[model samples]
Structure formats: structure tokens, C-alpha cells
Target chain A: MIEFKAAAVTAPDSGVSILEPTTLTLTEERISIIGANGSGKSTLARLINGLVLPITGTVEVDGLDTVKQGAKVRRKVGYLFTDPTSQLIMPTAVEDVTLSLRRIIDDKSERTEAALTALEEIGLGGKGDVSVNALSGGQRQLLALAGVLAVTPEVIVADEPTTLLDLRWRAHVGALLRTLPLQVIEVTHDLDAASRAHRTIVIDSGAVAFDGDPAEAVKFYRDLMFGRPTRTADA
Target chain B: MISLLGIYRPGTTPLHKASAGLKSLMLLLTVIVTMMVDDPVTSVGIMCACLLLLVSTAPPAKATLRAMGIIMVVAVLTVSFQLWRGEVERAIDVAADLTAIAALALAISCSTPMESMLDLVSRMVRPFGRILPPETIGLMFALTLRAIPEAARIFIDARTAARARGLERDPRAVLIPGATRTVGFALQLGQALHARGIAEEAKPERTEKKPRRDRRSEKAAAKEHAAAQATADAETSETPLVTYSTTKPANDVAGPTTAPEGNTSAS
Candidate 1:
């Protein structure tokens, strides 16, 4: 279970409240967050893994406080960034996965073998030595996920993981993200993807506007966006 | 799309399987020999031998050579300068020496895995462990490798974006944004690393007791550690993890701690 107790995020320079003080407990198998641009959706997802520590209150994953036990909490929470380039830090595909396994696997050759298996699992079997720079956007995202899953994290916090991809890749990655066995918390603009989640949270102006049935949440978000464009225009 | 510096082509060649440490040592020896060798012909032969050794790895020789075209051009310029000084023999010697060293370095870089290089780096810094944390250095090294290509790409994109805006020749137009973007990129890289928990490895552990170095060596180790701190401090300074927070008021504003660096795809 993940819980946020009145967690708030303030801009480091502007001193503006980004994420308003909010409290919520999340235990769903698949939860999707939807909001408009600058809606603080990513901030909310990042807090679960200590990527964005709150200025006040606390975020805990399965009882481990994110700030106090950031490292231990990170070991269990895998974050997938929107841009795969920065996340795919290694030169090649297999090497990237092997890097994640280094903490757990000691021997080099064994780690390489396990990394190869992980690549194969992601349908990138023949791309072990391929430069990460050469992989297509969709493929690179998959490779990033492969690196994350190699660590076997209990929770996956993905922030708009497929926005950069094409339509074909969007569907492919959407399928992949949906079938993941681990607890998945996704923040996406794709309404179809958001509707697929078991529960959806609508974030408006840094606070949880609605948290409930996916269809209802999406409907509320739609109304928030298209329904009253003038009201949200300056937001 | 490969760097001239890191175009490792793994194969069954002897150089491929040979240990990186051994190759590194041999490369060093060759450098030492180059300094002493008086005959240009011998140095030229050595350079060719090193090139042939690198070629034996079955790397895309054409691409590697093309990638390193800048180095070759610089070598030619150096030799030309020596020739203009009316020292033809000295020019040949300089050319041979430069080619020999570059070839040898390329061969080692091609054959060695980056992981081994990082391991060797950490091991080399172990003696200075008290003052310089090996894990931080190792991570920074890895980040540097990744950043070079990323920076190059960013420069190109920034230039293109400038051209689109009709300010292609304005130095400020290109340099300012390029630098700001790079700093932003560095911050994002730092954040990514922090999220992955790589930085935690450098922190002192409170959960476990570590083995003591040695009663006999402690005095010596501490003496060495203390002595080295002065030298190390002169060469080192702190690298900021993240800073410079500002954001426009919007529902989508990232937390102030979040770098406003553009993470959007150039595509």
C-alpha cells in the first residue's frame, strides 16, 4: 500500500505551491492519473518513489517512509521517465540492463547472461549489443522498462511513458504497461489508456479532484478540459 | 552513430578476450617506448602494428577511421608545422609518435568493456577512499561517457532550432540555450541517478559494521590518508546535485525541486 499524508510540493525558486496539501491512500492494482498540462500529475507520481520529496507531510510505500528510507524504498519502486534517452544511460541495450543487476549479481559474465535473458523477455533478443542510441523510440521505451524490471521492483511508477511514441508504438507499449504484474501507477494524457486502469484519479490544480471509477474519473477530467475550456484556459 | 572513443566491437579475436588491465599496461609501455625511440621508421612500424591489431578485432575500420578523422587532421597539421620548421626527419618522427599512441589508445578502448574501465578506476582510487569516494567518481565517469554524446546531440539540436528561428549566426543564440540546456540535462541526469538509488552507494552505512583495515596498517593508512587529503583537496571540489528552481504558475508546474530542463524530445 502507498499512502500520502498531506504531502505538498513547492517550487524551489518561485516558492509557489505545486502540489497542494493532500492526503490519500492508494492500494489499487492499476491506477491511472489524468490531468492537463502543468496539472501536477507527474509530481504526484514521482512522490511515491522519493523522486520528488514533499516539503511537508510524508509518502510511504508499503510502510517504508520515502524520505527516510529513500534507497530501500527505491529498491522496490521502479520509475519510468517520459523521455527514454536520459533513462537509458548505458551505451548499449544489454549493458543498461546489466547495470541494474550489478547490485544483486556479482559475476560479470553471469550478469551479462541474465541481462540477455531480460532483453529476450522484452522481445529485444537480438539487440543485446545494439547501441541504445540506435533503438527506435518505442523500442527504447521497452528497453528502459526491461532495465527497470530487471531489478524486480514491487511498484512501477510510470510518468507518461508512451507520449513520445507513434500510434503503433503507443498501442504496443500500452499493452505492455497494462499486463505488468506489479502494481502500476501511470500518469498519462491518453484517455483510452487511462480508462483501462482499474481506478483513475483526476488531478486539478495540484489536488485530487476526483478518485474513483476509471470511467467516471475520465468523464470528470473530460468535463474539466473540454467541458469548461475557458475556466481551465489560464490554468 | 557511434563515438570514435567507444566503438567496442566484441569478437573472438585475441585482443577481445585479453584482459583490459594487461592491455592498458602494455599501451603505457608502448607510450614510454615511443618517447625514447629515435628512429621514425621504427615508430611508424609500431603504429601500423597497433592499427593492424585494432583491425584484427573486425571493427568497422572505415567508420572508426572516419570517426577519428579529426585526430588524423590534427596529426597532419602537427607534422606540417614540423616540416615548415625545416626538420623533415623530426616531422616524420612526430607524426609516427602521434599515430602510434593514438592507435594504441583506440585499440585498448575498442577491446575493453566500459565496466572493466570503471572497476579499474575504483580500484585505483581505493587508496584515496577516505577523501575521495570511489562510487561517486565511478558514477560521474559513467555519466560523463553518456553526457558527451548527449551534449553533442543537444548542441546540434540547439543549432538547428536557432537556424529555424533565423538566429543561426548569433553566438548568444546558440551558446546560451545550449549551455542552459546542458545544465538542465545534467540536473535531469542527476535526478535519474538519484531515483535509481546509485547515489546511495556512496553514503556511509549505519546498518552494518565494516571490517577494520588493520592495526598494523592503520597508522600507516591514516598517515597516507591524511597526507593525501591535502593533495586531493587541491584537485577536487563539490559538484552540486541540483539547484536553480523557478516555475510559472500552472497546474502542470513541476515541484520547485524539479529541474525545468527541457525533457521534451527534439523529434
Candidate 2:
């Protein structure tokens, strides 16, 4: 379980506070964060992975303090960025996934085998040898996920993982995420994706304005985003 | 304009098919030979052979000439410098040797793609075992090749933007922001690397033993077969799919009635 206690995060230059002092515990199996632009949803996700340390207060993942044991915490909490292009460090798909397994699988043959298996799991079995720069946006995102899952982290935090994808791929990636055993925390602007999560937290002005069932949270977010009371539970 | 070094022109010429290790080795050997053979005839012969090999690869002649022009200018400067120092014979020999070396280097680059070069390096370093991850090094090379051009483009764009804002005269307006933006890009890249599980801490050792099968040879054959199949498929497809075509225009054709009259007219 991950817990953020009175976490307040600020941008490096602007001195603008992104996440206000707020304590939140993510004990559920699947949690979705919903917010408008500048509501600090991404910042909150970054905080979980130690990508952004809190200016005040503390964040702990599985009792591992983020500030003191950031690298350890990050090992447990795998992060997926919005852009796969940015995430893919290697030139080829297989090579990219193989990088993650390098520490875990000591033998050269085992690493290749594990990487291939991970690619096959993501429906990209034959693409291990292909250059990463040539992959389609959807394929790249899936490959990125394959790379992340190769590490076998306990918590998976994705920041708008499917934001750049088309409808078909967005659904494909979302479905894959739903099946993962790891505790998944996703920050998304997509209302439909938020609705599917077990719990949802809506952030407004750097604070949690609403937190409860996915349906209620979605309603609150829609109302806040569109400046009108959205029909509850269905829309 | 995109430089020859940056742009990749696809082809299946013999030069393209040559192993990167062989090409690199040949390039190095030629350079050494050029330096060793100070005789003018030997130098000129090596340069001609390099040029011929480069030409046979079928790269844009303009690119070859441009590279040659740069080399020649440098050679001339070196020769002039030697002459100024009262070393006439040394100047001619040095200039000739330098020309041969430059010609040979350009030929190698023209013949081999960046990815192939990286693959060769990776393969060459595999025997060393865990000192440096070949894949990581290859990826670094690819990223460097890709990012250098991108960073340059970004700098140009930033300069243009700064100039438009009437801050062109201020050095800080250009250099500071450009540096900041580049650093920001690098940070994003680093974060992206971390997110994808390719962080330094995540380097996994090669667990599998090398198979008896010649894997590199198999890979090359497989790539060729795939390319052949793709080309055949492209030829067979009746309606050529313009892969980059956006949804809006294609939508217009699929559902003519849905598009507004003005939009359809504009198209």
C-alpha cells in the first residue's frame, strides 16, 4: 500500500504549488485519479514514483520512505509516462524490454527468452527485432508496458498512458492494465477510464475535491470540469 | 536541409549488406594505410578507390561532393600551414594522406547505416561479458544520432521564437533559454528512460548461453526475407494505403454526407 501524508509539491521555477498539503492512502487494488489540466493529477502520480519529491510532508510506498529510499521505492512502484517515445530508451523493442530484465535475469539466454515472452504477452512477439523508432504509437505504448512489466513491480503508476492513442489502442491498453495483478494507480482525463477504476479521486486546485466510488467521482469531476451539474452515475 | 549523416535512404546495395564490423575494420585499415603510404601516387589511388566504392553505393552524388568539398578545404588549410612553416614536401604528402583518410571515412559512412554500425559494435563487444551492456551502448549511439539533429532543430526553433519576441539582441534570451530547453529535454529523456525500466539500476545480465546456431547470420537472413515479403505485399495491394493520411480526409471519402458542405468544398 502507498500513502502520501500531507504531501505538497511545487514546480521548480514557477513557485506554483501543484499538490496542496493532502494526506491520501491508496489501499485499494485499483485507483483512478481524475482532474482538469493544472489540477496536479500528473504531479501526484510523479510523487508516487519519486519523479517529483514533495516540497513538504512525505510519501511512502509499502513502508519505504520516498525521500530516504527513493531508488528502493521506485523499484516497487513502476511508472509509465504519457509518451512511449520518451519512455523507450533502446533502439529495438526486444532490446528495450531486455534492459529491464538485465538485473533480474543474469544469463544472456534467459534475458532474451524473458524479453520475448513479455513481447508475446503484449501481442508483439515477432517485433522484438524491429527498431523501436519504426513502431506505431499504440505498439510503442504496449512495448513500453512490456518493458515495465518485465521488472515485475508491485505497484504500477501510469500518467495518461493511453492519452495519445487512438480509440482501438486506447481500449486495448486499458484492457491490458485492468488484467495486471499489480496495484494500479492511473491518472487520466478520460472519464470512461476513470469510471472503470475501483476507486476514483478527483483533484481540483491541488486538493482532493471529491473521493469515493468511481461513478460519484466521475460525476463530481464532470460537474467541476464543465461548470454544470452532470447527470450522476450514468453519462 | 537535412545532412547526409542524418538522413537514411533505404537500399539493398552490396555496401549496405556488408557487415558493420567489416566496414569499420576496412575504414580503420584504409586510414592506417593512407597515413603509412605518404607517396602521392598511393594516396591518390586510395582516394580514387574510396570514391569509386562510395559512388557504387548509389548515395546522392551531391552529398558525396559536399563531403569531398569540406575535406578538400581542410586539406588545403593543412597544406598551406605546412608551406607557411617551410615544409613543402611534407605539406603535399600530409595533404594527400589526409584526403585519402577523409575519402575512406566518408565511404564507410555512406555505405553503412547508423543502426547497422551500432549492431556491429554490440556484436563485437558481446565476448567481453557485462563490462558494458552492448544493447545499452547501441541504444546510446542511436539516441545520440537521433537527438543531435533534434536538439539542433529545437535550438533553431527557439532562436526563431526568441527573435520574433524581439529579444534577439540579448544573448541570455537565446542561449539561456536554449540551454534550459535542452536540459529540460534531457531530463524528460532521463525520466522516460526510468519509467520504461531502463534505468541504470535495472541492467540485467545476459542469462542465456549463446546458441550453436549463427544467430547474427539468421537475423540478417530473416530481415532480408521480411523486407522482400513487405515489398511483395506492397506491390500486390490494389489500393495503396498512404499510411500517414489523417482520419478527417479518409472520413470524407467513407462518409461523404457526414462532412459539412464547406469543409468538403475546401478539400
TM-score of each: 0.84, 0.63
Top DockQ model? 1
For model 1 chain B, where is the 10-residue window of minimal lDDT?
B240-249
By summed lDDT, the worst window of 10 consecutive residues in model 2 chain B runs over B247-256
Highest-TM-score candidate = 1
User: What i-RMS does each candidate reach, in Å?
Assistant: 9.4, 16.2
- lDDT by residue (A1-235, candidate 1, tens digit) is 9999888899989989899987889899899999998989999999999989888788889998887778888899999999988887777788888878877788989999999999999889998877787789999999999989998999999999999999999999889988999899999999999999998988888888888889878878887887664222211
Off by over 4 Å in 2: A12-15, A229-235, B1-29, B39-143, B153-180, B196-267
Candidate 1 chain A worst ten-residue window by lDDT: A226-235
